[model samples]
Target: MPAPTDYLLTHGGHRVEVTYKNVKNLRLRVLLGGRVVVSVPLGVPEHELRRFLDENHAWILRAQQRMRMAAPPQEQLVDGGRVQLWGAWRELVVADGDRASAREVDGRIIVTGADEEARARGIDALYRRELMARIPALREVWEERVGRRAAGLRLRRMTSRWGSCNTRTAMITLNTALAKRDPAALEYVLVHELVHLHERGHGPRFVAWMDALIPDWRARRLAMRGTP
Candidate 1:
């Protein structure tokens, strides 16, 4: 099969990247930040591609709108900037110090370092430490409730997901960004992934299991995302 060709298509004031692949059907995806992508069979002519895009114009617009709405707001890591901590917005205070460190003082996040990069690193290290300290207890609680033990827990920064579980390996990976959200939200995610050890997909049975494990799981999800 030949490599996929990428080209730009603009219609009705919206631009989409069309990739022609060796496939039978056309696929459309609206990525985060409202980026549009379309995949179609290699032999699809430009006119047919245009017509297909026109037919799905409304869907493309709606998907882009939804993506924009679901996107998380960008955070500025600077002195006096507001950062989310445990579901509350707190002021960030950057200070110069011989050693870099981040801590909460007087209801504000204080990151002391020699430079901006150091301060940012210090804040990230602080979040990682917080997650390390908190995850064990949360995991233990949920493991006991679910009657399943996870192989291990790993933490990393993620933009698109809160957590993921490997049912086969019984390992749960959590988003380090959760340190910025409410601790309750972290617990919710832990419970969610732990439940995956028993049920793999988000179907009716999985939903029922979630309800039984965490009676208010839906509210926790909404609160975590700050959405309706």
Candidate 2:
């Protein structure tokens, strides 16, 4: 058996440490601070751990990059910068006019108001509008895939969880972060929440039903979780 510290790594922003124990599986996990650490059975060779990390190098880097980018300065909102809606780029334009509202015009989103401060408010308003525009399509897709009806769908600026469902009320609340992923992933999440109307928890039945509907849902779920 290799020494317990043989797999230690502090490269880049990720610090990984390894421990040997009596375990059935060689498990690798990224902690909340973006540190990836692994534990393996005592007899496993160090080469095996190295091979596993190398195989998953892409995922590790992608996770770290996402953690780094998620803390962007909110005050930097400006014109011509790309804001993602369903993982597609939407360019921003600031306009000074009588209309104190933001709108998506001519393939670009236009934020207009009498005061310069309205630009920031207008940008937030436009994000809400885009989300509203997507609700009907989301409901339709969910109905087809999950074979259930959602009484209502709401959007929120949630810090955790991409979406949630209230089976009692047949309502789903989706995190505004959905706007940051691809359209397909958004739809997948919508269907997922809608499915909760029929199945409450992510038990075996739910997994089977989800797999039945979206064959590549696991990949889409990983993509939304910021795994490249």
Candidate 3:
């Protein structure tokens, strides 16, 4: 494999960093500060790349707008900082413990004996615990509603997406970040993936199913995005 080269793609005064890589798809990302980047397959032609830019111009602008309007990140985890649990902000209490353990008591998250890194892990453990306790019930209810059963579920910290469904494998992977959002947001993501088990893409049929079942899914989605 060769190192990827980067160049600028400019369409209608919008500029993006384009990198030719081994990917089969043209991937676009609006990073922090609204910087645009695109990963193009090595074989894609210059004209197609430019057209991609033009076609996605509106989406890029919206993404930039969202970035600009999104709220600043939460404060660092410390003795008197705050924590997000099930979409609600609660006080953080750092206690004394040799290892990482976190629990919610009296509507406050208390972490004992953690440094910077362990503090993060402890909070993640808390989120995973909450998700695990809640997912089984949600899956049972949604699988019946969607008429498809997921063979497995995995949890991971994702940078971009809340959840993904592997239709071929009948597996669903959810982001732990969802634990930080409203409980309804997590339900929306799970239901969205459950529907994908039968509906392959986010087309008309998918939208219809989503609308029919999770009527307020769009609203939940907008709220989760934090820029709507």
Candidate 4:
């Protein structure tokens, strides 16, 4: 592949990075952290690119809006430090143990382990376990509603995305951090990724699915950024 040429295009008061690549068609994606990038085939004129951006301005804005909503929880996951769990702020209590482990007891997140880092891992393990326990029921409901079934679901702690779908494999990966947010946010992310099984992009059809299934998805997405 040849080295791609890059340029900047300002639209709707947002600076978009346009890369002229060797691809056949133009593609646009709003990455995590709200950066917008457009990949166009070599030799596509700037005027056409601007026109494309104008045509898809609304989608770009919405994607950016969603990206901005994942403002990571502000609290530390240390002993005596506070943390948010399922959209509620809980007191973090840590104790020494042979290995790392955590659980919720009496409205508090209790971590048992050797050190602060271990306790943090215990907390993350708790998040993964929580999400793992909850997603099966959600996937059953959402797959039926969306009329698409994923081959499998996995969890990971991600900095940039809430969830993603692999159309070819029918597998979905969700951010474990979601277990710390409002339960509603998890449902929204599940539905969003599930819909991607059929709709490859967040274009009109994908929006239509979101509108028809969860009318308040936008509100739930925007609320993910708020601190408890």
Query: Which candidate ranks first by TM-score, i.e. highest?
Result: 3
TM-score of each: 0.62, 0.58, 0.66, 0.65
lDDT of 4: 0.84
Write down the worst ten-residue block by lDDT for model 3: 67-76
Q: What are the per-residue Cα lDDT tens digits for candidate 2 across 123-203?
A: 666666777788787677669767899888887777778889999999888877676678777778888887788789999
TM-score of 1: 0.62
TM-score, prediction 2? 0.58
Candidate 3: pairs in clash: 97-113
lDDT tens readout by residue for model 4, 72-97: 53576565566778888776777768
> Model 3 residue 79 lDDT?
67
| Residue 227 CA displacement from its true place in model 4, Å | 9.9
- Give candidate 4's TM-score: 0.65
Tens digits of per-residue lDDT, candidate 3, 1-228, equal 554479876776777788999898999999877889999998788888888888988998778756744546564588656778888776677998869888999888899754878888999999999999999999899999999999999999988889999999999999998888889998999999999997989999999999999999999998987511
> Could you give candidate 1's per-residue lDDT for residues 1-228 as a string of tens digits?
554488788876778898988789999888976788999898887788889889989998778656643555446567656566777676677777847789988877888878777777777788889889888777777899888889999887777899999989998988888988879889989988988888999999889989998899999898877421
lDDT of candidate 2? 0.72
lDDT of 1: 0.81
